[model samples]
Target: MTSAKALLLLLILVNQQLLTADAELISLTTGAIGAGAVGAFSAIFGTYSYIKCKFNECCDDNWIPGNVAHKLQQEVDEKLYGQHIAQETVIRAVRAHVSKLKPSKALVMSFHGWTGSGKNFVAKMIAKSVFKKEMLSKYVHLFVATLHFPHPEEVEKYKEQLRSWIHGNLTLCDRSLFIFDEMDKMPYQLSIFLFLSNGGMNAIVEKTLENYHSGQSREAITYKEMEQLIKNSAFNEGEGGLKTSRLISRHLIDYFVPFLPLERRHVIMCFKDYLRSRGFPTNADEIEELASQLHFFPKSSPIYSVSGCKQVEQKVDFLYSDYVHEHYKKHFIDDL
Candidate 1:
């Protein structure tokens, strides 16, 4: 049993003993001392009950036990652009997992995509929907491969520590969300434990282009088509952590959600979205200019964004620094 459970048992036994003693004392001498003893026991038991309730309710502020599916769907639809496959897969998987009274295993999703293709964005959305404090919540843990486990020589040591950290956190809050970014950079050994990025970029792009040329909507792409492609690429190509990892072999990962590369129109949408977020007017000309700054892929076709919307916010801010400052200053002065 856990330390908390042991402490609770101890408290229960002590309270029982105190209750028995108080009853005998009250029966023996109906005096001030007996009445005082009875009052003290009652107070102790009440304190114990309060402590128990607090322990149980400690995670309430961070975790919402309600239907997270609707909230997640709404957030994804509104904020996340492109990658229709990722949007649908995540919602259905999360809904099925969360709605269960007791899941057979933890919900493990491996996100595969090129940089700025909304892997991190979708992950954040999931965290925001499930966690009240989002990324700031204690229960939401994010581990970047390059930062957390950089040294390949220390793989064994990292493995032990990683296991302990995950186990301890789950003990505290089983509903915890763990996001491992840059899985492509992690040592193959560590990928056996957790699953991230750049594992299926080519497949995603090629398939997307194929769909477009076939006159199918981007949303028409199905999870079934992407799943096998992503799994194969993650397992076979590159020196990515997922390559030959037991997590893939044992099939521990629940889903390999693919985030497709963004097109010119999607990049323009991102530009407008960023501008709106900063309280700036989304002028047609300005939006077009901002979108123009980003480099797209396939020099022949030039259809998909090379960096997607990754640098959009920074680029917008850098280009319109003076305007942003003036807008904010005007607002501040008006308020005054």
Candidate 2:
């Protein structure tokens, strides 16, 4: 009986050990499953939020917030000088288009013309009006085509990548703004990827011409004329034809705004802007003097600023440097 009791006790101990091991394994499995479930839920929630914002026009980082649309119009008019009619048209068009919460198509604006004619400046204004951080927003993708794809051989690769990038960003947020700087430099075939109009996806594309001939007599074609021109160019296989010509032949360009060469008045206005930006008071006489001193190229037939407003600030700094030197020479003559 004592032996039987000892055997029973040993069996009970063995069963208890086995139960403890099973309990430990069950606890570990439950813990792992719970952790996985939490992670998955977090991912799902994040994705849902992103999709919700895209559809509702309330992207966390992209869409223009309340009152910004109106403010943007004012800022564009005030800051972008000498482009009065253009600015008004842009403001009107953008405001009207964005008022529709769900636009079926993306707003595409093509800015072409002389250098320093506010093509890029207007683009930045549009971005600022739409986003809180404006150009700095994650949703704003600025691509210089020439800088991005330098080799002709990389055209195919660039096309695929560009398409994927646009599609992926649009999927994440339809309100994405893409600035294609130097659109003229973009390989014709590669540029076709940008005009893809897939349903349920929308984005703003601003294309700027960076390599255009200064002072070329362009007829300032309207959007309709541009479309017609594309059709003719593609069908006729005309000079300056693009591989993507066929694709853009029927594409609807929302706006094809042309920037004209800056006149002396415009240059003066630009200098004032530059001075103001650098915390200098806008003195009319000083601005006029600087504008007059700016040399134009092709001395006989001048149409645009030699360097646009690009060198205006540099000129201002030089003048200030001269002033400082003169003052020092006059004050410290004895010491010298």
In candidate 1, what are the lDDT values of residues 1-336, reduced to their tens digit?
533333344555855644334322332232333455456556766786677656543465424456588999999888888878888888998888877867778888888877888888888887778877777877788898789999878878988898898888877767778888876654311111225678778888898889988999998889998898887776677565466577767878889888899988888888888888888788999888888888887887898989988999998899889997888899999999
lDDT of each: 0.76, 0.57
Candidate 1 clashes between residue pairs 3 or more apart in a chain or in different chains: none
Name the 10 consecutive residues with the lowest summed lDDT in model 1: 185-194
Per-residue lDDT for 266 in model 1? 84
lDDT for predicted candidate 1 compared with the true structure:
0.76
Off by over 4 Å in 1: 1-57, 61-65, 185-194, 328-336
Give TM per candidate.
0.80, 0.63
